[model samples]
Target chain A: MTWDILNIIGTIAFAISGAFIAREVNYDLLGGYVLGFTTAFGGGLVRNLLIEIPIELIWSQDYLFGIAFLGITIAFFMPDNWIGHLKKWVIFFDAIGLAAFAIQGADYAVSIQAPLIAVIVAAVMTGAGGGLIRDVFAGRKPMIFHSEIYALWAAFAGFMIGLDLMRGPYATLFLLIVIVIFRMISVHFKWNLPHKK
Target chain B: MTWDILNIIGTIAFAISGAFIAREVNYDLLGGYVLGFTTAFGGGLVRNLLIEIPIELIWSQDYLFGIAFLGITIAFFMPDNWIGHLKKWVIFFDAIGLAAFAIQGADYAVSIQAPLIAVIVAAVMTGAGGGLIRDVFAGRKPMIFHSEIYALWAAFAGFMIGLDLMRGPYATLFLLIVIVIFRMISVHFKWNLPHKK
Candidate 1:
């Protein structure tokens, strides 16, 4: 997928999840919006600060307002089953976002001559940062703590993007797609790492 | 008026506000602690970042566990009406905190040889940043935008502290006291800039 399309999907998916969680927690409209915006873009903000992106647009209100609209609109029409039946859908889209954004972040950081480690870190952050933040805002332990595969998936995507070993944009796109599918399958099947759960 | 005393007060006041505001919003125990810690120490996080301070403390279980205790203890024992009645008292101490931290911020920046304007901005932020973040986390426009003369009052104190002429510590402390009293009076009398409303 083109990066633009992927980004918009990622952003909207994030916004929706934040809205859904806010509803579960009974946040007010503005609070729901705040949660949405932070969930959608907090990773980007963290990346910018760490990677030296300008802070102006990040701090501005465009993305914030967009997420607020999404949250309120969702709340206005949501059914009781939306929360329970939608868990898998949220996770699937979330994995897609993680892969795409991780590649994007690694590319941007590497383009700026960031160290390899920094590239990996920034990539994983751009991918998983929003989810981590949403959990924090919702007062829940982050999925990253419970799910090891999520970060590792982002790292794999980031590694390919940063190393520039991929042949073309299609190759990079395929790498991201593989990571996304791999993560979804891993999560669905209850894959575990060496550490204790 | 010593910096240490002011620092302690600012931390405690912001922490209390965090706890109180979360309770007002009907947050659970963990949520209350999260809000309080974010309000009390978030500005210091930004301040440290601006000056390249490490951010490890924000995530330490020790800090988290401590803040949780601090908040839950207040929530457990304090009567619901207690904080509401102590609103004025909280504001008074908070103003002192603002003045103290603002000065501390400017002094630190100046010591690090940041530009004058940068130092000035840092001072203003250190004064109000915690409250601003608290507002964001709590889903409201920050109280600084309300009829409080708090930020400017802190700036005035910071100016005196970072004064190039080098006054005695006692003089700086006296200025902080003056700003605190002035701020309390302003808030009590509904004093505000005429054009703002």
Candidate 2:
């Protein structure tokens, strides 16, 4: 039940984020819906593909799709001033979504008995892949590739899960909180990966 | 045996194409290799995922990967003037690759008893998805979405295969030739899909 709740929250948050980006790019309504749907589910879809899970699993989540659509529709209709005010909150929710999805992805990989590297990859991809795809579609460099320490936190969670250091709902919840805090701190500090000048 | 040969030809052509694009974008050798590999196999990867085929099928093609690497390496070492002179040949090989992959993808989908729409999607994606992914990684809009009538030929091929109008190796070869000629003609004539001004 807890996992389901977290998944729903993450889906709605990603849907709104995608809708906002579509609006920024001046995409039509259909584009907005497509982007919104992709953001909400693209990560999981990629993860499932990598893990060789049935693609039908994605189609089975009908309710989640409805929730994502609802979230995007609401975002589409919101006033500009309201969106401006919600920017910070959107970031906060995005962090929550990232954390939840990372943990869930790691858990799924671990359950499947995937190798440690695969587990970590599943986590990072599930956490950041949607945003990467979204940015690519919007004709921008993927933020995860150049921005603050984002996917690294997801990697950390995956490592812990792969090593069997984290298990159970409480432990998972604790890790999720830690990752969210670390991600937010990195954002606030403007931390970045090293690159050649 | 024929399918395997066609697959190899397509893979090498795509790898060279990808390496050229990576060079155009000023990516390093490593980037060239990555892009080349993606452009060679990303379409099949996506097609398999959509068709629920085991992802391991991609990894099993060890020889194809080696050929792709070789093709990219050759492209990387070639002088710029040589590349300019070979540009038309590259386009011709690319058309061959597109037709081969499209027919192969549609055949696979039909063999699996997938619906007509799925077969058509499989064809188009297998034909053009690698280039789409390559352009996205290069931080550019997908040319297939806006450029010449590339995927439509793939769709036409797929439709024929799905309806069982084209069967047997001889018929398949004929269709492949037809698609390649149509693609080349489209390029020469500057054919394009309709869009808003």
Candidate 3:
């Protein structure tokens, strides 16, 4: 149940980012939905393929269509007011989604007994791939690759979840709280990695 | 030996069409190459995955990288002359690519023992997918969907190839001729699919 909520949360968060990017690009309804679809599934698609999951099975997954349909509908209907209002909450929503995806993906990789390094790699990619894709298609520099502490925060969140899981029901709420607090602090301080050039 | 030649012939033909479309869109160098790349590879990506080809092994097979590099180079350096001198040749070049892909895709499917219906579908997709993707990213209706018997020609070519392997080589050449002739006829008559209202 908790995992399901996180999945849904991630989907919605990415969807919002997708729609925002579309608005920024001045795409029509179909274009917006296409962007939204990419943003929501780009990460999972990469992750699944890397893990050698079959293509047909990915399409057949129930949550697949559910997320796509929801995203498309939102893009089609919410064009005018959505982009501006949505951008306001982007920092919060995106951070939550990133954090949730990081934790969930790390858990799945560990369950598959992936090597520790691979787990970290998957977790980071799963958390940031969607945004990177969205940024590229939107013709902007990706947040993670920028000096922003965005991907790092997600990585930290995923690492902590992995550590906690290795150690108890370890309240899912606690995980969420930790992610939110770190993200808020990071954004507040304009925290970022040091740049060489 | 024959397959290698046919594939290059097809790629050159497709590259011309890709360059033409990108030029039509007034794409910059990066955009033109990107469009050309999509035209060369989209269908194969879709087919390789669907046919469960252990795609990693087959992904870079044939003249993909060379042709792609050649195509993009042409799109960049040779585009102006190609567009100016050979406006009438688009139909022929596109026909060659489509026919070659149709035949090759059908043969590959049969070699893998796919159902005839599946073979037909794969052939059509492999022949058309790249151009379709190219069109989509450029925000235009796909050439086949918009008009002039392009996809139909692919179907015919694929069907002929799948009917028999030994005869398939001659049939591919025959299909190429047919597509070129028919496309020329369609262009003269200004034939097109009816626009949906």
Off by over 4 Å in 3: A53-57, A76-79, A161-173, B1-13, B17-38, B46-52, B56-79, B85-197
Q: Would you list the rank order by TM-score, best first?
A: 3, 2, 1
User: Model 2, DockQ value?
Assistant: 0.13
Model 2 chain B poorest 10 in a row by lDDT? B25-34
* Per-model CA lDDT versus the true structure: 0.70, 0.84, 0.67
| Ten residues in sequence with the least summed lDDT for candidate 1 chain B | B188-197
On DockQ, the candidate that comes out on top is 2
Runs of candidate 2 with Cα error greater than 4 angstroms are B1-44, B50-53, B57-132, B141-197
How does residue A10 of candidate 3 score in lDDT?
A: 70
Candidate 1 per-residue lDDT, tens place, B1-197, comes to 35656776777777788878777777777767777777677776776665554567545536444644675467435986776787777888788778777877777777776655446556766777777677667775455643346667766655665566436687767777887889888888877642200
Q: Per-prediction TM-score, please?
A: 0.57, 0.61, 0.63
How many pairs collide in each candidate, listed in order?
0, 0, 0
CAPRI accuracy category, model 1: incorrect
Compared with the true structure, what per-residue lDDT tens digits does model 2 show for residues B38-106?
Answer: 788889888987886677667567678779989998897788889888888888888989999999999
For candidate 1, the TM-score is: 0.57
DockQ of each: 0.06, 0.13, 0.11
Show pairs that collide, candidate 2: none
Candidate 1 vs candidate 2: the lDDT winner is 2
